[model samples]
Target chain A: MRLRADLVPQDNLSYQDVVLVVDVIRATTTATAFLEAGASSLYLTAGLESARAFRDDDVVLAGEEGGLKPAGFDYGNSPREAKEAPVGGKIVVLSTTNGTRTAHLAARSAKHVLLASLYNAHAAARLAHQLATEEVAILCAGKEGRIGLDDVYTAGVLAEFLQIMGSYELEDGALTALTTRRAYPDPLEPLHLSAAAQALRQVGLEADVPFCAQIAASPAVGVLEGRVGEALIFKRA
Target chain B: MRLRADLVPQDNLSYQDVVLVVDVIRATTTATAFLEAGASSLYLTAGLESARAFRDDDVVLAGEEGGLKPAGFDYGNSPREAKEAPVGGKIVVLSTTNGTRTAHLAARSAKHVLLASLYNAHAAARLAHQLATEEVAILCAGKEGRIGLDDVYTAGVLAEFLQIMGSYELEDGALTALTTRRAYPDPLEPLHLSAAAQALRQVGLEADVPFCAQIAASPAVGVLEGRVGEALIFKRA
Candidate 1:
């Protein structure tokens, strides 16, 4: 087995059999929390218009752009919001700045796509290992064109879990991630110092910092099953 | 002051005032060794043909393709070769796989470009600090568009030095590099475990590993002053 780590979701990411998309500062964290909180499923859309169009009585519109909730969105892109929202047995239509776009892009080429964060790193890694694929790609949903520390740190956490499973050959990026995880065993330091975390704190969302920093808080893994028309449906893995 | 770290040289890197291009596992390391070995100056070129075309009585063609010296090249891309070569008062024309290509790309936009490696990291950082440019970019010459552990680790070493010198806002990549440096104070561990190091050992070139791992072995910083016709001229910074 071979494990590859991509610091950012570059254009050509269609080669891997399984791809774990990570946005630890809260997109994937929120998604996993929603699943763990009893949301039936989620429809991940990249554009705000698609998310709004897919919303209904049974669907909750959750997401943020520029760290602020949209005018009519039901919830902002916060794990705290997902934890408190009425998501039981409901389908969540989600859109955000980076995470959902990365998921949509990964869905184009990846046979199986899973959302990973510190909250669901172990579950995501176990699911990837269970798939028994030759290659697993961990794609970080970096902020804009640059890498975000929190996302890469979360990728390191996932890489560490995958490495512990045995019988895997790690590529350079994987080794880098593993080394990173070893260097900082405590994930909270890097996350608190991350640009995304600082932005959240500036926006008076300091509560989200410790909330998103929880590792393995949820055993739920958000797996992209397939597309339902224009929406990418994520089922619990 | 702002410090930015790019794990790999992405396309169109036309943003910084001063760019420090690093290839820890041989190119920049070898170049630093050559300059420190009493060579008057070195010429860096990305293409083999360009390296060959610039050769003259006083110039020696040195480089490697796929870890082996080419048929017509004067020397292979090895610091050991450079350290022993009769390059005294001679201009060494150089070309390698990743390092030179990254330097060429960085030259397009950067006002000043310098070659950095573990051998010359401290010197490079001091030079960057001395330049006092508003923005400084550390571009890692990654292996085939992927992050190379050796390069990133060396970048971290440079970042650590720059951070200690003055107050500067670090971008995410810079913070990641700084964090990496703090994680591994001893540079040899990551260099030995790097993919490039394994490849060198496979080809019976394991001797280069320890030679390249010596931090601050050379105080010379390879600064790209200008081009003579087609060859890039490097002076001691």
Candidate 2:
């Protein structure tokens, strides 16, 4: 088996059997938490308009723009909010600045797409190992078009888990992620030191810092099942 | 002062006072070793044809394509060959797969561009600290527009040196580099584990592997002083 890790999703990605999209601090983290807390499924929309269009009695609209809850949204992109929401048997439609875009991008190219973060890294790795067809791509949702430390650090963590799970040849990007994981063994260090973390702290959302830093807090593995209209539906695997 | 580290040069880079382009595996390392071993100067060419065009009695042409020396080139992209060449008082023109392209790209956007590698990382850091106008951008000449572990590890080493030399706020990329350096304190580990190193070993150029791994082996810092038509002229600083 071969594992390829990309710091960000690029336009030229070839076909992969499995693609794991990571957005720590805290998009995928929140989504995974919602699933673990009994949300039936998540509709990952690429924009605020698409997410809002999915509003219904059985759907909870959650997302953030510029780190603030969009006007009239049910919740911001916070794992704490996802964990506390009354999401039992509900479909949570979500959109965010970076994570949703990455999910949709991966959905267009890979046969199977899984959401990964510190909350579900190990679970995602295990699922990937079980389903991969000789190749797996870990795509980090970098801040805008640039590499974000938080996502890269989480990718490193996930890469390490996959390395330990099987005998596989890793590409350069995977080696980079492994090296990053070795550098920051404590997940909290990357959380506290990341630019996204600092931005959150500045906005007085300091509580989300430690919450997003919890590694494997949720056993949920979010796999993209199909698309419902303009949203990609993710079911827990 | 502010330090921004990029895993690879992006098309939308902002203006910087000083840009340090690094390709640690071979190109910049080889150039630094050449200058340290009494070469008067280097002419960094972006293409094989351009490098050949500059060939004269006082100039030697060198480069590599697909990890092999091009036919009729005076030398390959190997520090061992560069170190042994009698380049005293002569100009050595070089073209490589990645490094020269990065040098030219940085030259177009920044006031000053310098070549860096593990061999002259400390020297490049010191020079950047001395000459930067409140901002320094470290651009890693990654392998074909993707992140290369050897270059990023060398960038991490240089970022650590810059942090120790002055008071500066590091961007996320720089912080990542510093963290990587902290993880692998011994430079040889990254060199041996890098994809470039493995390729060199496969090609039977194993001697260049350890030679390129030597930190601070050369005090030469390649500063782009001028351009002769399409070639960038470098002088040791």
Candidate 3:
């Protein structure tokens, strides 16, 4: 099997096979934390109207624009904020710059859509390996419309793990990733860092990067089984 | 300037600053050699009929399908066959897995499009850098529809040159190319053994790998002026 990576546009979610949506600077990490906290489900939408629509009935309306949580929303794309409290029973609506669009695109071409973060990377890779039929594609939430190193680096973490476990061959992108993984002589530093990581640090979320950088900390695999209201929830398809 | 690498479908060749249409194994190498021979102007078409349409005293129908040159063609996709004579004054119509499609794609996006190979890499990079307008994309033609390492490696060579010159900042897929270039301790050894390189060697073109591998050899860059019949020729636009 082969792996392909694309820095897709907000509307151009062109993909096939299993689409692994990554917004490592925060979206997926935050969502994983929300799942860990206690949120029963998440409503992932491209627009704020969807979050506002679901603002009632104990819903935590959440969204991030340019990395910061917007006004009036209960939360932003903060993994710590999401994981800090117990959300096991509440529903959270979420949105962000790159992650949300990736979710929508994955839905268009995937047999199964999955959300991956450093937190639950191993489970994500293993599950993808278990269920993948033809090939595996990891779509990074590149900053805006441009490709960023952080997401690709995060994708490399998962892509490499999957490659080793499944003995899969990779495309040039994935190979470059594996090579990048080896580039940083420092084992402590991540293969790459995201703009969101820097922003979170500025907002006094300094502890977030290491947490965000922790690969496969969560063993849970988040799959986009269905869209509830507008949020996508992780479930077995 | 931003540098990026893309794996586009053979059909989609329209959005790039400088398209490095890579048929690393054969197509492009043969075309480059054909240009070295005395071909006046080459014709690049989507099908064999288009090539035959231009087949006459003025044009030489040259291409391949499933590796070997098709029957009744003046030559195959072999650089060795092309090198038997000089091609300073004839047009050599062509097509292959990666190069032709890349040419079409570059024609759509690049204000100035150029053909690159190990034969004329230094010149190509210098030309690409000189003509680049804040964005330069290298399109690598993989085998069939896969991401061939040879093209990606070639792209890496270009990226390193771009970075060293301080004229470009790597972005999009090109950043990944940077990773590929740096990943290996020794590039020529492992990469030259890749399947794409092997295919070239099978045709007795093993020496070309070293020539292609040489950091910066020939500095003559091939730019596409316009669609002249079928083949793409390098000319100032």
| Residue A164 accuracy (lDDT) in model 1 | 84
Predictions: Cα RMSD each:
2.2, 2.1, 4.2
Regions of model 1 farther than 4 Å from truth? A12-14, A228-231, B38-40, B228-231
lDDT of 1 by residue, B92-194 (tens): 9888988988888888888889889988888999898888569888999888788888888888888888888998898888887776777776788888877
Ranking of predictions according to TM-score: 2, 1, 3
Error of 1 at B104 (Å): 2.3
TM-score of every prediction relative to native: 0.93, 0.93, 0.82
Write model 3 residue lDDT over A103-128, tens digit each, in one string: 88788778878888768888888888
DockQ scores of all models, one per candidate = 0.58, 0.57, 0.28
**For model 2, how does the per-residue alpha-carbon lDDT over A58-143 read when each residue is reduced to its tens digit?**
98999998887898899999899889889999999889978888888888879899999988888999999889988888988887
TM-score of chain A of 1: 0.96
In candidate 3, how many clashes are counted?
A: 32
The TM-score between candidate 1 and the true structure equals 0.93
Interface Cα root-mean-square deviation for all models: 1.5, 1.5, 4.6
Candidates 2 and 3 compared: the better one by lDDT is 2
Worst 10 residues of 2 chain B by lDDT: B7-16
Model 1 residue A179 lDDT score: 66
